[model samples]
Target: MQFAGWLGMFAASTAVLAGCNGTDAADQSVAASQLAADECPSEGVALQVLGSGGPIAEAARAGTSYLLWIDGEPRLLIDAGAGSFLRFAEAGGNLATLDAILLTHLHADHAGDLAGILNSGGFEGRTDPLPVIGPDAAPRFPGTSEFLERLMSKEGGAFAYNGGYLDGTENKPLLRARDITTADGSGEASVLDISDDFSVTAHPVNHGVVPALGYVIEAGGKSVVITGDQSAASTLFAERLAATRPAILFAHHVINGEQGQPRGLHRTPSEIGELAGVMEPDQLVLTHNMNRSLSRIDDSRAAIGESYSGNISVAADLDCYPF
Candidate 1:
């Protein structure tokens, strides 16, 4: 089939020249399709990248967010970063059926669209309470509950008016924010949520002093671990996640080992490669790729590939993968 030009751009963009330190372009031609309209894989759990970019706004990519399609429904949304709602709209996901949202952190680029999502849902014809989960209050960060209160509470939340959706008659969103708190330094995996077919677990990951979390979404005999925007300064997190035997690791980091450079609490590629080597996941998808990683995709993949023999895929908005 002739590829659509936009898809060609997407496929081409994801490719890291194989000769560039042995990086592979193996999957580029499989399905070069528009991210906004791509269909989820029909079986197992399918994850679609809604926004693949990060903190800095970029015309070519939205912020960090993902949609999980289960039983053919886009029911779970992971992270609601800036402009994520637009991506969600373009992707044809039904807002009314969204089950829950898992926020890896409260960073503007990670959970910035929380209110936007709730506000938009106010018009999506949903009556059931929407669940929003995030980490507990840290020194400088507000927990999920506090954040929701400040956003939807009449007592000064910026969007208190949107809270009315929780009680409105039709086409309104009812929201419930759940905060997961594990004492800092505890590498224990805390259960954020559990269901018949799947469960979501979180553990602590180092991101400077911020109380951050890394999540594992387990379903259909498959596990996908998202390492939030964390550094691999410690081995506890990697060990905790490896125990899950993940099929995929959506690592949000890039390699910048130079000192005096602002690495912004993210891990370097070699660190990620080391972790992936131990986890031995079938695939290691490097995401939250910044300008550095974008310009040197092959280096990032090659650095990671040095230790991990698994397939390495650079994620782009709308790319879909099923477990």
Candidate 2:
């Protein structure tokens, strides 16, 4: 029921942005009453699912994105699909301290709705530049910088009008893109950000020709690994993830394959089991949900349980995991 209200509020944000009729005072009242701040924690780490669905839309879940909160503040964002921005707001997170934005790849399902952050007046209370990191270019996908240029470059870009936002106009900070080397399945991992508080590492994983990479984010002695649409069967994934020893594995997956579509891009439940069995994370969270996967969650859990004896949870949109 809370998630249902979130979907409505997310829609309300879009309507409010799209010139929907309403008085400012009334909107503020409604927002204040409905979207009040939650009792966020003061320490440890919390993994919040802003979105959890697959390429297609589903009523139960949004797209693929996760928010990493430290000391009750959202500091790192992984992917920003279409519906995630609104979900971010609905989840009681603001962009005030979002320092890093990581992308697994340039697939629309993973990085599509980044415009919400770069929009001139879309958000509030943030003036710091955001560092967007992802894998280098590959056969079909655009590199991180190229991808941002296509989205917000001043000239001849998809969101050209967002130049003002990208340039930090009106005292707002710009959004910067930084491409990191994705270790080519050689058991090597590339460090994207390393600070005294937290560190992030990227490891290359096969997603057909998508130039994909998985991420390991660690802070405060708690860690979580996110596989953004990675192939569970890839040897590189096994090698890279096995090294970090993540506390939780947020792996993408589907229950069954479809006809006339390719299965090389995603992992089957068995494949996920194989990887999870090898990593043996303290907990395993099956994300990137789809209709089939949601319907057969028990079957999927049973299948993965065959290889893994760890705690497993199917993530729903807005689900929170504190560690």
Candidate 3:
């Protein structure tokens, strides 16, 4: 989709921006109670699906978002989609503790909640600059830094009032949006960040005409690979992460290879299975669920099970999978 159309649709679909402080005491208490019941375990390294649904609205799930919890803190975030603002709060995500934000692509379902997330983080008193890494610009897409400037630039941005993030002069912290080279065959995977706890690498992937990326996060002696929306035609992703042997592989399950489906934009069930067979992740988690794919989940499982004999799971919003 074109950038303008995506932005318009996202603006219409997303809820009004209301920070955590907007809630009343009783509402906060009830939310906290619910969070306690549905939150991920705080003792180990795990991935919490803050939004498991795709671009389309699904009452049971949110859009594509994830939070990586290490020990007890929310360390990293991936894809802050439309409804993830509330899910992030429910998952006990604290920007004060979060290390960075990694975006696969600038699609509405993948990054619509970015401004909301950054604006909400101000409430937590985060002063440190946060890195927002994403794919470089393509024909119809804006680069990571340009995307942020268009949204938060002080002079003329969609949310000009929130321009503090660009320079760190206002009450909010600085947000550094770095564009990673996503050209195929660009040497090895791009190492985005590394720290004492975890290291992250960005792998280039083909998502039709859009510049896209897949991520490999290594922490706690385990590896997790998140295959952002991509076609099955390319083997670069599999070839790059062949040795990683991820503990969990979160592959996008957006379409069935039906006759009229967009084969260049997404993987079919058979394609997912093929990648799983090669990667040999300990667990294969099918995420980015859309209505069409969800309707024929049995078929998807059957197809994937042919090549992959390991565990397969269909992710749901708020579901936590430990490594």
lDDT of all predictions, in order shown? 0.72, 0.72, 0.80
- Off by more than 4 A, model 3: 1-38, 184-188, 257-260
The 10 consecutive residues of candidate 1 with the worst lDDT sum are 27-36
lDDT of 2 by residue, 1-323 (tens): 14435555665575466444554545444443323223335577788877878888765466898888777777888888867877777666656677788888887777877777456233473667777788788767788988887777788788777665567765556777777665443435777663556888887777776777888888778788887776654687686567456789998866463221246777777778878888878999988887777667777787788888889987767777776
Q: lDDT score of model 2?
A: 0.72
- Residue-level lDDT tens digits of model 3 in 124-145: 7777898889989978899889
Best by TM-score: 3
Q: Highest lDDT, which number?
A: 3
Off by over 4 Å in 2: 1-42, 120-125, 183-188, 257-261
lDDT string for model 1 (200-270, tens) is 88777777666778888888778888888786654578876664558888887555442313455777787
lDDT-better candidate, 2 vs 3: 3
